[model samples]
Target: MTAMEANTDEGVIDAHHHVWDLSVRDQEWITGPEVAPLRRDFLLADLKPEARASGVTATVLVQTIDIPEETPEFLAVAADSDLVAGVVGWTDLTSPDVTRALAALRERPGGEYLVGIRHQVQGESDPRWLVRPDVLRGLAAVAEAGLVYDLVVRPHQLAAAHEAARLLPRLTFVLDHAGKPPIASGELRPWADAVRLLASLPNTVCKLSGMVTEADRDRWSVEDLRPYADTVLDAFGPRRLMFGSDWPVCRLAATYAEVIDAARELTAALQPAERREVFTRTALRTYGMTFTGSQAPQEAPCA
Candidate 1:
């Protein structure tokens, strides 16, 4: 489908997607032969086709590993792509020169595209992941840089995520993938309660993306992600919730168009104006993107 045909309405921005090249970088965390399918290079050109097919005119490239060098590399790449509006790259939050690293990254070739910072907190063994002095210092630095902090954590790590927010009340934290909820077993209370707790803090925002893969993977339907997505919506409302495709990663469960259609199907009750906020406005605000001079959203294609 063409751009206009792909979007039921215009101004949609897919807030999360990932791009990586194993040849140039080591995505060591992408272990096992089972994940080998995603080990190859995924550049902007590779993503645009799918983005176009789903009316995803804007996208945010998230970090896949804990590589300090990766953020600048992405900035350089995003500078050349119209489709990539911002990037959420990694930094050593515990490093002694964390502030310097943030400054240097902001000065890089594609630094203008840098909107947020992320650490692979989910990979950590510590349940109270964010309370570590080094990690807390790092989070403070992100707030100092005026960049959002993308929280990548599993359900077990959410309590720490909440503490991180409470500890640093001034920081803006964007929860990736609805706290990476467990949908395969249909367990919702703890995850939902934890999410509501996090959302209660006015400084936090949640992304309504990556749910399809978090569910039963191959067996997931749009309905499976509803509870988790709705919890985010009900807690944060349309203004704080943003849409993301979690592309390439999303490819594991569903195609780009399929994911967009599923989210739209679930959100059908919202009016066009409200839907526009979920797809565009909230993301632009949360990520500090300015699309003021960009092309306006096109009308849906004629049948």
Candidate 2:
């Protein structure tokens, strides 16, 4: 629809991205004057065009604003949209009725679309934000519900994420944005250390999404993101890693094709099978999607 092609080169699965509409939903967090670019509504129909251009057959719709009312709303949206294969909705994990909340969210028509839970842990000031007893209990509930936990943390909070990985060995955790490392500053040591530590846990996975936005917004090269991307691959290997476009957020840093190109170039040295997992298979497994649908796979030109 937008003249963009869905990147089919590597069997890609966009592990993370957000879909919101101010009219039907409350995305107040993005209403601030400074965040205007993200204020408008972005529903599934709005996304399908770009998603198709990017060769994204399936996607996991993550929550934008933390609202209990929004989780079920998203599940309803997912129920109607074929492209949105999974949802990583929000829940009051800290609430005493956390399990009940999850149950209610799962019982909706599109409740089957919910594959994971995520809290905006990066917004917290506490370095050890995820280790509190209440939070740990919530994570355990997520595990018990058979859902994955997505860790959206900043670099300082990654140490806490690593700690959470060690503490909750049964919970499946995915590190969003490669820990949101400082690619703009070109700093990698501390983030690399934390990512490696988290990956050492068998249940943890890393997402190769959102790095472009972490680099200089107006000016950045694929080379600038290479070290961080390479490090994530080395730490998690292909099976424990997945691809994501971060979409409209990525629009601030690069086009969908540009970001996809960068990732393909970064992982070019890997065998086809490894690239396949990072691009598609792992996401299918993690988000519980069946890739046996009738849509034929499209091929992409090499960058």
What are the TM-scores, per candidate, against the unseen true structure? 0.92, 0.91
Q: Which residue runs does candidate 1 get wrong by more than 4 Å?
A: 1-9, 294-303
Query: Model 1: clashing residue pairs?
Result: 75-110
Model 1, range 153-200, lDDT digits (tens) per residue? 998888889988988988999999889988888999798889999998
| Candidate 1 lDDT score relative to the true structure | 0.81
Q: How far is candidate 1 from the true structure (C-alpha RMSD, Å)?
A: 4.0
lDDT of each residue in 1-303, candidate 2, tens digit only = 000122233366677878777677666566564457776766678777776776677778888767788888778877777666788999987899999989988887778888999998988888887999999999999999999999999878887888888888888899888999999998888888888888888989989999998998888998999999999999999988898888767777787778878888888888777877888777766766655535634433345
Count of clashes in candidate 1: 1
TM-score, model 1 to reference = 0.92
Provide the overall lDDT of each model, using Cα atoms, as 2-decimal numbers. 0.81, 0.80
